[model samples]
Target chain A: MNVKAMQKKWLELGVEVEETEYAKTGYDFSLTLPAEKVHALAEVMLADGFYLVFVTAVHALPAIEVVYQFALASSPRCRVMARTAVRADGTVPTISDIYQGANWHEREARDFYGVVFAGHPNLVPLILAEEDVDLKPLLKEEKNLKDISALRHLPAEAEPKEEKAPAAAKKEPAATDKKAAKPQASN
Target chain B: MNVDVIEDERQHQFVLNMGPQHPSTHGVLRVLLKMEGEYVLDPQPVLGYVHRCHEKIGEYKPARAFMPNTARMDYLGALIYNQGYAMLLERAAGIEVPRRAEYIRVITSELNRIQSHLLWYGAYLLDLGAFTPIMYAFDDREHILDTLEDICGSRLTYCYCRVGGVCKDIDDKFIERTRAFIERLRGRLPMYEKLVNGNIIVQKRMKSVGNYTPELCARYGVTGPLLRAAGVEYDLRKAEPYSVYSEFDFEVPTEQQGDAWAAFNVRYREIEQSLRIVEQALDKLPEGEVMEAKVPKKLRLPQGDYNCSVEAPRGELSYYLVSDGSDIPYRIKVRTPSYSNLSVVPEVCKGMMIADVVTSMGALDLVIPEIDR
Candidate 1:
């Protein structure tokens, strides 16, 4: 399949192809499709005789990139990678309807990154505990440090030190006289 | 007399829990079998007991670090997993290995193949209530392991193959030892045939039992000897040749029966072919730099997804890696052959006896850790 024909096919389906890069390896093209058109794009790929290799997600700084790889079984050498980025908040369409093999991979993705695939039949935890599920472990660590700093600012550290307390006891009378003299200044 | 009459009229179907501990179940696998007087009814396999979450660990480790970890998943065919991971990294990074390194890889892989088949042959016969064959198979396997261990550091989990090439080169003495072992194996093949292949009882138990058609084989993504037994000539070494397999001349053995007997025969013949491959690789061993140019201290692959498949003893083992041009992979998915091959057991074991279920499952070579991982 030529790039022009594939691009036309995607355009006909109302899927906007953001970019297409040719791979130096055996794979011909790498297509970046919109998030909404993932299911439709997968349907087209399957119809064009592509086998689902696997699905994976990458945690980019601001957004999460979900990549689905497929290849023609007869021509196993040629590969096509379709990527779509969803917000880090976790919202994307499911491709299980197109390829049954995506069932386990999607469940795994959901377990690790908290990516929610809409219309997935079974969305329960596959590899991790449901009760302890945390979407952001790194963010949790940052919040923990801020909580510790706030606790330290509560005037609890104003108490006298042990050696200073002994010295202050001897000078208590003089300190009181000085306080009385500097009352206006203290106020 | 009245009690006896009532007992005779009672229902006989009962449930039996086989393993999670049973020796026959192989590793931490548990099968819930519904039985009706020695015949099985709907054996539901309960997995996850041995799941170590290898993929999760691989996600954190660097691409090169995954070489050692690959062996732990399928301990029986550890070197093949090691080779598969190393080969994928080599291909992804476009590292060129020398001709001698390729030959050595072939030699070690073939030896690993023999060891795997011997273990499979022994264990399969043991499922049929024969114990002596396993001992015989182990005797031969021990020699192969000893030879491999001498060249590589470890015995079972051989972290031998590096990213670009082998970790160390094998001297002429190692090559001579391997050649002698091949000759010894050729002489012992007939002995194995006489011991188990020609046994009347073994034939009765294996022949015409647990037959899987070629169409079902492909539908379930079965490969290696099991697919070949069903008459699909789809060995990755031939179909998608890798690691100097194209230069070597050997046959991909196939059996038309597609039964337990056929699977057994195919594996038996494959051992011979593997031996032939090792001999050819040894004879035509080239001399050159074993390792490729030194890779970076901190290796990072380009942002891409790569899927590579290799022929393991059980079937086709595929590793799908998604790299984001980072030290750690974004995702690592292992499509283990045992997982797919074992999934079709319920479909095949529906009408078979309890004994036949064990036979069929064993013939499939259900490595529970590989499946559960």
Candidate 2:
């Protein structure tokens, strides 16, 4: 579809596309949306015969943003880009169902930026080991990271109602005591 | 209804892990093969052995300083990756490349691509149990490396490309050598065809094996030989026309079968096309300044994110750079093609024999560090 037609189609899908650009900078066109709406936007891209090239994130201080770049293999072959502002530890629904290529792309994004894909079947570390999932190598600046704890957004710890103090502090240590007691890999 | 979940499909009886230490030029990738006797039920790729955190490093360094580092990603086609980054920064900053450098870039990179395919033809055949062809392939490829090394000052990991243009200009000696080498390699193709293309053993191993339709390749974002073999003529150099690629004339070869043999044929034909491109580029190599003068030492991109893609040897190598209008880029994402191409293994390997897994893997022409990075 032409850019005007595509923009109209996106509007039809309830996507408020930011703008249409024919080869502006690196992307052909770009759309900015909230984190929850990325999956909806991706469906339009998939239906329009776009290929999911890569899913990545940029840690831009106040907000961490995820970028999904797509290329239309159909005639004209215009490139499309989508950017969404994700909260630290924000979850974007998986597109692996639509494009199997997104599975590893999402994993690499999560491994580097700690932005979770809510429904990825096996959301383990891809380039990083399971234990080093939290390090998030790409989050670091020259001297130190801009932020770490907030990188992988988790639910803000509930006010410890006395007895639940230590359990609320960590992800799964005290909660999954049975599995923690079993074993660990030799480092 | 979804793939990978396999609702009522049979479960795999055994799991086999092959290589983080593979002898192929495609670096440290471990494939977990779930097998039932001699057939592969599922093939899962486990990566991240050599993640250098190159993007993180990009954020810490100046844009110009990061040019050389791109070569480390796809070592086999370092020059191609180098051009993609250099041209990206140039486009962002509105820097113009001299016409002469544009011709030179096309010539050298095309040579690098031919050398890369030669290595793949040899290495892939080696994996499929043929050793004699590699000797001829490498012997021809050695001349390309030597020629590039003379002009660029490096062999494998070329840090030759700079922001506005390449680091050095080629003399007539370089031009004469490239033309001679092209003719020599052209003469070698028929012998390669006789030994491998027409051989019954190769046909037994390759024909109708590890097949992927054009639709399957497009679904998983596969490019280069894999896509061409599946009968799509979607070459970025032809479709999008970057650099001097438009000025030169060549064909985008395609095969209808979408099998391993088709992919092999695509790569072989591509070598001939690239040779034609180099000859045309050499014939049209212009005379002018090779570098854009007075380029700013400290580069600052206008605050925006842009993407650029090149037809690399393996597939489409794209660079997505997001700049915060600072000397250091905010993010530099390489959309390396192997990552997507290899992702299709699980989909394609669903019911193939165990040993055919090697044949399929060989056909993908994966370079592991590209995927891992």
Which candidate has the top score in lDDT? 2
Work out candidate 1's RMSD over C-alphas.
Answer: 15.8
Clashing pairs in model 1?
none
> For every candidate, what is the interface RMSD in angstroms?
11.6, 6.1
Q: Write the per-residue lDDT of candidate 2 for residues B253-320, one digit (tens) a residue.
A: 99988888899999999999999999999988889989888689888775566678999998889998
What TM-score does structure 1 among the candidates reach?
A: 0.76
Using all chains and alpha carbons, the TM-scores for the candidates as numbered come to: 0.76, 0.89
RMSD of each: 15.8, 8.9
Writing each residue's lDDT as its tens digit, candidate 1 over B302-336 gives 54556677789888787877665566766677878
How would you encode candidate 1's per-residue C-alpha lDDT over A75-154 as one tens digit per residue?
22445666666533356788876665566557656665567787887766544445535532212122222111111111
Model 1: DockQ score: 0.03
Best model number under TM-score:
2
Interface RMSD for model 2 amounts to 6.1
